[model samples]
Target: MAELLDNDDPRFAFAALKEYAANSGALLRSHIEAFGFSGLETVELDVNAAKGLGTLLASKRYAGLVLDRYYAHAAAKWLAAHPTLGRLTERAARSGAVDLLLREGDGTLTGDDLAQEILEDVLRTHAPNLTCRTALILVDPPASDAAAAQRERARSLRASLRALGIETALRVVDANRPGISLPEAPAAEPDLLLNASVFGTDAVFSDEPLFCERCEAAIPSENVEPKSAGGQRLPEPRLLVETAARPLRSHLLIEARRRGIPAVSGFELEVARARAVIEAFLGRPLRNCVSATIERDIRLEAENIVLIGMPGCGKTTIGKILAQRLMRRFVDVDELVAQHVGKFKARIYREEGEAFFREKETEAIRTLALKTGLIISTGGGSCLRPVNRALLGLNGRFIWLKRPLAKLATRDRPIAIARGVAALYEERAPIYSSLADRTIEVSSIDETVRAILGEHA
Candidate 1:
């Protein structure tokens, strides 16, 4: 396994990212943090609205590299090495690499839980970039107790940032779950060695590998079976001492002298974060960032953040974090259902038709502009209608709440209904994305919260 690097080193991956973009007309929008050096401009890309980075790529001569969004490490390496596909990317570069990165190529929506069907459709049939140089990589927890016990038994994101009270700072690992090891010899070393989020999981990528105490022995669900893909029994670590002891001790030593965090590994952190999520789901009081108030006016100073995403993506929880971090109030539109219909929000969905819920949602949308110092969380359906979106955009900073549809299994919200959840998510995702001024995928409540406060995210 590769090792994750600390930020102390000059982040060189981004330098390569910039060089590639400058060599060609391409520009990239990705979760991987850009370094201190500012490029030409920092404009938001509408990932939910459209597809086809070729035309976009053709437009710029700068050679910027987009962070591989969806695929895992093996896929990135394979695509990077493809003979014909690799040539096409080079041709695009020769043609004067106009576009840099396709931000949302990882999932359908950029950072929002907006529409993905159209974008996915285009990618499936028309994508020339599918086998391009960019590839998404996986960095999952190990199938062991180490994976489970660290950071209060939480995964990477939840463990590290949550302890710091960084709520909105959800971790977007560069590598995907059940991580793929990088192949020897392909592209040279990266210019910018930026590890976007603290850990490298399915949510993101980095030049170095990430270490999480939790992943040492925790086999991913897909790989839980004893039989391997090659018709053989796969190796399983019987003890943390053998599989994880060395790695854990090695990283632990570095962290101790360099920057030892309270958690065991990044993956362990995610599991620990479940505490905060559970608290939010139960409507518990929120925590503060350190003792100091960023500014009481932070709430007043904060522009409205309109959350858009598929169902069960933690919009409300993230909203709560943003509100707390900014020292503002939090609002969940679903909470109003009980006030409006004399029934709990879920019961309202059960008794009153979804249409009735929409009607009430519209009412909530209209009320946003009149208020300030509030972080508003809305239902996935709320962003579907143009009228509701218009109301949300009025002096609001539209943000997409992106998360894998699969993670819903761990959540207990009403939106976690089993059947057709993906379909419903597909239907509403694009609409939510269309309205977002900025998009951010919610990997964990901690990472999401950290982002709101403008920390290491």
Candidate 2:
């Protein structure tokens, strides 16, 4: 099995994960079976760490090479000489998979070229059975030369798709343009949207901005305001492919999921490429599905759990319990508002009024939405505004905790007290149902926790 990489060493993160099934618990009472895997280990590394990659490759034990688009061409010359890969290339030629060989250029083949090659290979190999007829390539134009290069790349991609019997269209947009409106789709909406844009990839990872700062100036998602052309909403593509590896950091990915569009992360493509190379080196297929497992693991570790419902529906209580059990930080939007106001929620309602309290709530939610891996409990009325809903829903799985109105504790909750429990429930029930990703009845607290865990598991 290929080993998982540590981020500290540039070569550490190149593992092709294999799933193995094993029986547990010897002849015990009611022999229970279970699944297990190693934990993810994330370490930070810089561009200089690429030196370690060369040193590691010299060891010869690591035959497979999978690199980021930016670094692919940098090591292409050395990679072309791999004895195992050379043998595999001969086999691939005999089998008529001509593109299997690593193509070289006169030091002109760039990271973009390698990325395009990988994209083509992935389409030809894995999604060969796809029935999608239309594709749109959205480019983020930099300089005039870069823009032209991107256009040429898109044209090449279009030709590749055409060879696969899929008609494709190209759409280039200025990612920097304010209030950018994407061009309307043709008679039929595009089946796939290939975001070759820098929207997600340009942002600086604050903790590790040494590399990012050398590229483009960082743009926060809050600054990007993309709207559909005209007054109507842009048609959602069936599949969205972000060329950026870190989809979680992208606003585009968040918006895509919220609109029910299926997305493919650029990292998935990298993993697929790595898996293929590793399988070739091993001379046998690995017993694992790359995309689904990686996607699930990333989501399970990074996504936030949000509890939203009536004022006294046990969101806070259950959220605390869930957070403790799952080992995630617990955040209460109500407490955030109170912390900002320097008073209790009811005091804020009485002294500063509801508008002031809501403003604080929105500010808090906006900040928290940018973070990940938290268990959040919202103020009963916090998600009433669409912006709040968007902020929280961007990275959270909202769960509605439903309980009998009479059973709810309404002592300190001014809103629930002023507005009768029945009346408030009648007003907010529909919104809760609409916004919740999962709805769990508040039976016993333990049962409710189990239900939430089961949903996530």
Candidate 3:
């Protein structure tokens, strides 16, 4: 984070990350939230593809990372062929654990520097929408023999997060073993025992907490989102969570629920502290810090979604479908001009010349971009104007609905006439690529609409 990009392509990391996030929603969301965030949503960035996400939210918000061992070591091992690691990477690639998010470095930095980068990124997004009372952390799966060294790195991260007004915890756990153990409850028996029988009798004995060699998966949590994959009800937060303390440390934590609390896993504690920080920063209770997914009596606000493409690339056709799906009105700039000027689009192009038409097109795109949130489609050349590109980029996302020229055979935009039809494809493809958060390859209006909604929905 302290060093600038040594190359001209500074957005390299951002671009790589956007692609990962776009495709792997479940993984990205889980890892980011685990790092301590109030809320997060992925967006198409005009930044680097290989870039990692870093935000300094408002003062008092918690920000940090919950990383795995693979992220810490793969860079040192695989020099040429490695991407960042995490749930998304695990599910998507499934080959190895690599860093899905990494700063621009030799990838051989000391753990302290790696920890610094993680804290910096999360804190960058921590203001206004976030409160300053947050902390960041770096979680590593137990891998290194140097436990003391790892602890020092974690300590450095904790100090940094605290400097940003966050309380932090760094942990390393053995993924292959039962998680770290703590003291027992007063009366409630430990769900996990080093070696216990079903009837609470000793099956076998060991100094370690009992872990079943037979069971493959960790027990599910009842309240975790999307429910359990096995559909089994999750037991209450026991073992790791204390039932004796006031105000729950977890399992649907709320100030009102704090009572007879117990211990919590490092991950759970980091999350709890992060949320608490957000609440304090916002001057609201922790219960109110997180956003709700439920629409809950929400009123629809008119929105503007402007589609920008070179020319004749199915903007009108796709725009109509997207608007219908969104239940918002649609306006095609070329069609709107034809309707207002009492002339066909081609007629206006021929009679008024390209310059005059471009002026009108620019004004229409500008106005449409500003109007609350209606969906608007622009002509192929609309993106040639920087204003149009900025409007689409800043106000909302840009979807470059495209296909091979073979797929666009009969499409007719102005560029089709002045130059050969192939020329249109050659000229605008790069700009379209630059302008879009995603380039959905579609052969028709319907497919294009589906792709757009697929991401937005």
Highest lDDT: give the candidate number: 2
Per-candidate TM vs. native?
A: 0.34, 0.65, 0.37
Tell me how far candidate 2 lies from the true structure as C-alpha RMSD in angstroms: 10.6
What stretches of model 2 exceed 4 Å from their correct place?
1-65, 73-132, 143-170, 174-189, 198-238, 245-284, 289-295
TM-score of 2: 0.65
Cα lDDT tens digits, model 3, 22-97, are: 3323333343343344233233332321233222111112222223222333322232242232122221122222
**TM-score ranking from best to worst?**
2, 3, 1
| Candidate 1 structure quality by residue, lDDT tens digits, 52-99 | 233333333323333212211222233344433332233222221111
Cα deviation of 270, candidate 3, in Å: 26
Which segments of model 3 are wrong by more than 4 Å? Answer: 1-303, 409-414
Q: Which sequence of candidate numbers ranks them by lDDT, best first?
A: 2, 3, 1
Separately for all candidates shown, the number of backbone clashes (residues 3 or more apart, or on different chains) is 97, 2, 73
lDDT of 2 by residue, 280-363 (tens): 333465566743564365566557888999999899999999999998999999999888879988899999998888778888
Worst 10 residues of 2 by lDDT: 24-33
Q: Highest TM-score: which candidate?
A: 2
Q: How accurate is candidate 1 locally (lDDT)?
A: 0.38
Off by over 4 Å in 1: 1-302, 409-419, 455-457
